[model samples]
Target: MNRDNEKRVTPNLDENELMNLMVDGIRKDGFKNPIETTPAEQPENKKPVIREQNRTERISPTEYEEIFFKEVKSTARHGKSAYIDPVHHKKLTRIVQVIGDDNITIYAYLYNLLEHHFREFEELIKEIYEEKHKPLF
Candidate 1:
């Protein structure tokens, strides 16, 4: 035998041996990775380092309130109208019953609304085209 092949050899570790070695190291370290821990120091609240007036004009509380309330009212009215549309409300009720409370029903209703709008658009287009270019009748 050649000297290269005749030397005593150590057995290679199998998967289980490698896994056991890792588990043993982890157990000896109390199951936590060795990491440095440093306590955070509290930041001092000092005066502004650089004082500068805001370039943007700030709205007064009254103006802010008026704008906020107007937006809230407008959104509430729109939401009520959408929720109370008889056709949409009925379809939504049926969909909820069938689908068991899945929120995707809202998307389904939106898709149906879009489809209805598209049909209306097609009708309007047909009407306009017919008026502009009457059939050769």
Candidate 2:
């Protein structure tokens, strides 16, 4: 058979075509390809099925308590948290700028200011307190 009349086939063929050649005992330049059983011939794999996440999962009571009360604890000891007007907030920020300490925080400046005006600040905070917590005499 003339090479020109015969159709050309490359060594790198598709997986199915290669399998078919192996079954047919065809080799390319003495390089034999291994025969792989068809996927249908193998048993179906029992893959672990994954379910969608429970979007409406409820938080546990302990988890809720931890998150809700974590920050609301004694502000006097931990530090007071106030939602002041933006203008006052900016003024407080300016005080830290004037102090010229790069490491100083707004809390330190605010605490220092409160300590300076303890009489006034004490009265203001006391007025908002639910009940006058008196120490046992």
Candidate 3:
């Protein structure tokens, strides 16, 4: 049998048919390439993580109540406009209507939120702002 003279018979099966044949043969031989994990082999009680996934410390409802009714002490006021998401705006409006008296408008609610945020991150915010701040000579 001369190697050069012998014509190799190429199988006429399509790619999918060829793959199926190869896979069937491999499976029959008890050779698991990827090693698929069956449901029965896996732990039945395995649970996904359900802990507090908040990025910041979880604030109590009392804290929120305090912030919601906190009096604005700063006399310095600036005229500015804010574009809030429609859904969030609606929610805020509802909250203000429910929790607010004559003193707490949407403006006040947002200002208090900003004030709380600034107070919490005052040092970090100051540092970052100072780094980027330029004084006109």
Best by lDDT: 3
Task: List the candidate numbers ranked by TM-score, top first.
Answer: 3, 2, 1
Candidate with top TM-score is 3
Q: In model 2, which runs have C-alpha deviations exceeding 4 angstroms?
A: 1-77, 119-137
Can you write out model 3's per-residue Cα lDDT over 29-115, one digit (the tens) per residue? Answer: 444344556767756684333553563467776788697667665432564666899999999988887877545777778888888
Error (Å) of candidate 2 at residue 74 is 12
lDDT of 2 at 113: 51
Q: Tens digit of lDDT per residue, candidate 2, span 19-133?
A: 7666655655444544666756755683333553663366675653333223222235586567889998887677556543344556555555545456535765677573677
Clashing residue pairs in all predictions, respectively, total: 0, 0, 0
Over the stretch 1-137, how does candidate 1's per-residue lDDT look in tens digits? 68878796977657765676675554546534446433343245522245445633776756533332221112232443344688967876776455434533444445454554577478776886888996678
TM-score of every candidate: 0.23, 0.29, 0.45
Model 2 weakest lDDT span, ten residues long: 65-74
Better of 2 and 3 by lDDT: 3
- Residue pairs whose backbone atoms clash in candidate 3: none
- Please estimate how well model 3 matches the true structure, expressed as its whole-model Cα lDDT: 0.70
Score candidate 2 by TM-score against the native.
Answer: 0.29
Residue 46 deviation, candidate 2, in Å?
92
lDDT by candidate, in order shown: 0.52, 0.56, 0.70
